[model samples]
Target chain A: MTPAVAFQKTSRHFGAVRAVDAVDLEIKPGEFFAMLGPSGSGKTTCLRLIAGFEQPTSGSISIFGERAEGVPPYRRNVNTVFQDYALFPHLNVLDNVAYGLMVKGVGKDERHRAAEDALKLVQLPGYGGRKPSQLSGGQRQRVALARALVNKPKVLLLDEPLGALDLKLRESMQEELKQLQKALGITFVFVTHDQGEALSMADRVAVFNDGRIMQVGAPEEIYQRPASRFVADFVGSSNVLPPDFVQRYAGQHRWGSLRPEQIRVRSDTSGDGVAARVVSRHYLGAATKLSLDANGLRLHATLPSGTAVPEDGAHVMLTFNRDQLHLMEEQA
Target chain B: MRSDRSQSAPTGLKIAAAAGLAFLHLPILLIFVYAFTTEEKSYQWPPPGFTTQWFAVTWGRADVWQALGLSVQVAAISTGIALVLGTLCAAAVSQTRFFGREAISLLVILPIALPGIITGIALRSAFSLAEIPFSFWTIVLGHATFCVVVVYNNAVARFRRTSGSLIEASMDLGADGFQTFRHVILPNIGTALLAGGMLAFALSFDEVIVTTFTAGQQQTLPIWMLEELVRPRQRPVTNVVAMVVVLATLLPILAAYYLTREGDQIAGAGK
Candidate 1:
């Protein structure tokens, strides 16, 4: 089957700024894919390129095997759920949801019925009569999702759809969106700055930085074996050991990543481990995060809640399982 | 704390607000008071006596009717032309980026910013240079020059406030350009346009300086009233017509105010 969306060396530039630079991407049909990056990293620009709101400066795009570059968004068989929801304030919930069908010349009764069904899919039944302003932020988000889903497009582009919601609502909506993508089996292209959201929700994740794809892989692979220093630093909090530190520990002069949780702190200094001094300690509910100085290099360790942690300014031995230390391919 | 501060406004501030309102409205109240005065020839400290007969006399005057008719026609046509041209200009300025876009926006608003006499003299000379005779249409053309500024100001502000994502979302949902405008953009800016149109109508109706230069042989209500003031036949009648002008202009302005006061409530605003 043809890929849901493909970009061939797509680049979008605004004057001197390279918003998206030579990005070649393929989103598989029926896969939950995420373009994850920080702000100004071109993730949202990539989503807009797929939606045809933007034309690439020097590339070609195809959607479901059809040429999409320069094709107007109205003619594309795709829909977008904007970060702001963008629900029409003038229309009630039903009309807003049914807008796509109505524009396609669906009859009023049929379109309204379809809108109701879409609302039900988002678990917002009987909310068809309320104006968008009357609904809370989460409800508005659901309405935006319903509006996009009502069109039943082959590809759905979401630009930080849960970004405006509070943390609890965001978590719940993430689960709902994941389940919805599975049930619908449509290609979902989600763009977000939150790495945890991307890792937990996307089947395959593409990490973007400075207008380029840093790495793309399964979420587990991305977490377990980041390919670059940027990915290791951005994806999660990891103690990026220098090549000299790695050479001292594992006899390899390669940059390595050791997760904070993987570092074990021994109170007694009688061990064949790196001698370190605890510089500071933070008591989390279920864990204690320690900032340590080992041979003038700063490293962090997360000790489990039940472990007895030494006070700040105390010397300790820091040990890690040899297999838990992952080497990075990038020099810096 | 907010309620406490709001409830205890300073007495000096309260007196100042009342005095400000009285200063603004006392002249208008004087116009209303003199409209009922029986005196016809000269100014008086107070009304000699109140009478309802001048209203009957003012209603029967054909010249008054003719001036009122010309004023209404000029205002209506000028507002219609301003609405179309002003909205188009606003859309161009607010929705697109090009070289000299800011300059174009400044040119659109320049008529209202310059002194009215300068605009009038400029328009009068331009009309004469073009060999266009001053007629009722000339008055409308003059009124529309300033009226467009009113509508354009309101429309451009509203267009800026409306989120661009709404338009993008409309297109993403499969709406063509016209459909997006009709279903999304229009609704978002509908009240603003209405308010702008009303204000344009109000401005065009009472325009004196521009109309004086443009209307060579025409007598809109204000021009007629000006002539009547110079050579008095019934001073109270001019006052009655002034009352009529005040009501005509005041209603639309009040409506415009109420329409736009809640403008920030537009959908997806601040999102």
Candidate 2:
């Protein structure tokens, strides 16, 4: 079977700034894929490219095995849930969700029925007559989802659909979206800058930076063994050891990194591990994060809140299993 | 909610507000009072007697009916033309960007910004130079220059306030360009256009300076009233027509104001 969406050296440049650099990515069918990066990292641009909103400036993009060159967004068999929801202000909930079918000349009754079903899918039944302004932020977000998914496109492109929601709402919506994607079994390409959002929901993730994909792998693979220094630092908190330290301890050539949680902390002060001083401690409800100074190198570690860690500014020893260390090539 | 501020205001402010309302409306009230005055030839401070005979006399005049008919026709046609041209110009300026966009916007508004006499002289000379005959169409064409600006002002403001994402979302949901315009853009701007068209009609109905230049031999109601004022025959008759003009123009202006007052509360507006 053909890949859901493919970018063959696709690049889009606005004037001198390359928003999406030469990117080649293949998203598999029925996969819940995520494009993860910070702001200005070309993740949204890549999603726009697949939705046919921004045409590639150089190479070509293919959707569902067909060249999507010059195909307008309306003609493409894809839908986008815009970051701001972008629901039609002039329309009622039912009309907004039924807009796609209405444009395709579907009968009013048929489109209304389908829209109601879609609303139910998003668990927003009986919200058909209300205007978008009448709905709350999370409700509007779901209405946006219903509007996009009512058409049953081959792929659903979500552009940070949860960016406008509060934290608790975002978490619940994330679970609902993951479950919805599984139930629909369509290629779901979600774009977000929140690493937790990307990690907790996506089956596979493509990490992007500076208009380029730094790494693409399963969530565990990306979290465990990143391909580059940027990926290792961006995906989660990591204590990236300096090159001189790696040369002294690991080898002369390898670059080493370890997750903060993997670093073990003790106050015995006589163990076979690096000696460190606890400079600061942040007491989170479930876990405590500590900033440690290990032989003049600053490092971060997370420990369970109940752990009997050393007091602030107290001397301690930090250790980690050698197998937990990740190595990467030195970037030029 | 601000009762303290109102209570703190001096009595002089309340007197001044009452004076302001009287100053603005006293002449119109005088016009109405004289429309019923028994005297026909000269001004009177307080009429000796009130009568309804002048109303019938003014109703029987054939010339007044002709001019009133002509004025209504011209206002209607001019408003129609203004609606189309004004909406199109507004859409082009508000929805797209290009070189000289600001210049074009300024040009669109120049006719309304410049003094009416200047616009009248410009249109009169242009018509004469182009050898177009002065007719009903000439009067409509003259009124349209400023009428278009009125409509354009209201429409451009509305078009700018409406979010562009609505149109993009329409197209994203499989709407063609025309479909998107019909479903999204038109509904958003519809009330604005209606309010604009009403204001344009009100202005066009009582237009005199431009009509003086463009009407040639044709007589709109204001031009007829001007002739009646100059000739000074049965002055009460002219007062009756003035009352009619006031009501005719006032209705549309009042309607337009109400239409736009609630326009800010658009349905489904984003928070």
Candidate 3:
């Protein structure tokens, strides 16, 4: 089947600022695709262009295989859950959810039934009667979700849908939203500035920077094999070895990225590996992540809770297979 | 406001405020006092006797009834015209910007900023220059000039406070431009428009100077009051008319204040 959403060399400019410079990508149907970046990275702009909130100054976007050029957002098949939810203040939740159906001239009885079904899908079955102001942030987000999902568009765009929630609530909603997507089987194009959010929830992520896609792949592929220093620096926290390491064995060191768990903490007694000392240790519940000074380089090692941890001054050997190490070419 | 002044109001200031309150209501109080006073035979502080008969006579006056009807007519027509023109102008100016948005804004504010006499004279001259016969319609036109400012003021201010995101949300959900305007923009602005309409009605009802200049043969309440004040036949009835005008204008303002007191929340990202 054709992809749920596609952007073809899309470029959008605002005066002197290039909000979304020439970008090309695809979001597969039923895939939770995330556009991850920091603020001013043009991720939201890309989502808006796909949702038809804005037209590309150049290139084109298509939803479900059809060109969406010059199509106003109202005429488009996709729906958006805006950052602030944007619920109608004058209306109750039922009215807000039913708004799309009402505008489409769906009869009262059928629209109400659909709104209730949507509300139940978001687990807010009785919340249809309450105004948005009466609900908490999480509830409001769920309402925004139900409102969008009710339209049954080919793609559902979420622009920082959980950015407004508390950290705990945000984490919980990430799983909830992921589960919701799986159950509904609708394409989700989620835009978020939070790297953790993109990683934890999305099936595939397109990491963006300065109006360009730096890398795009499955979560593990992008995390384990960042294409550049920017991607490695953006995703999972990784320590950069000296420039000489990437320059000297540039091809052999093609293992461009490493997870903290992958590094084997070998004993210093009989080791040929580069030597490092423990600098700091944080004992998280299940594991301990140790920050180390490996000679002149900074490295991170996450050890299982039962592993023998070295003291601050104790010498230790670190052994890692070639696959654990990643070589990233410098981007100009 | 000065740093030298005490943070709490002094005793002297409190007494002065009490006196100011009394002073503002003093004339209105005297109107009712003189309405029942037998000293109505002559303008005097102390009336010889109090009689409630003038209230009955004032109620029965044909001229007062005619003026009341005319005032209602003028107020209705003026407010009706203002609601459409001011709403359209507010809607037009609020949305689009051409060459002179600021200049148009200044023009909307101009009529209310000038003294009523200037506006009255300008309308009279414009009518004469154009050779349009002065009638009830001319008075309606004159009242509408300033009335537009009242409605436009409320409507535009409320429109600015409404979230642009709500409209965008409506559109993104499948409503077209007109439907979004009707379902989202219109409901959001309904209170403001209602408030503006009330204010325009109040302003147009008691408008004297402009009505005087514009009403050639027809008589509105304000013009009739001016005539009664000059001729001096039924002074007590003038007090009754004043009371009616006070209630007519005050109720809507109070209602508007009550209506906009709630829904003061700020939501949406791109407001």
Clashes of each: 0, 0, 6
Name the better of 1 and 3 by TM-score: 1
Please provide, for model 3 over B66-119, each residue's C-alpha lDDT reduced to its tens digit, 9 standing for 90 to 100.
Answer: 988988988888888887888788777876677898899889878888888998
The DockQ leader among the candidates is: 1
Off by over 4 Å in 3: A240-243, A249-321, A329-332, B1-17, B38-41, B51-70, B84-111, B117-142, B209-219, B263-271
User: Which residue pairs in model 1 clash with each other?
Assistant: none
**DockQ score for model 1, please?**
0.80
Runs in model 1 lying further than 4 Å from the true structure: A249-252, B1-40, B43-60, B96-107, B129-132, B263-271
Please provide, for model 1 over B92-162, each residue's C-alpha lDDT reduced to its tens digit, 9 standing for 90 to 100.
99988999999999999888888888989999999999999999888889998888888888889899988
DockQ values per model: 0.80, 0.69, 0.72
- Arrange candidates, best lDDT first: 1, 2, 3
DockQ-based class of model 2: medium
* TM-scores of the candidates in the order shown: 0.91, 0.92, 0.85
lDDT of 2 by residue, A55-94 (tens): 9999989998999989999999999998888888889999
Going through the candidates in order, what fraction of the true interface contacts does each contain? 0.89, 0.73, 0.87
Please give the interface root mean square deviation for model 1, in Å.
Answer: 0.6
lDDT score of residue B177 within candidate 1? 92
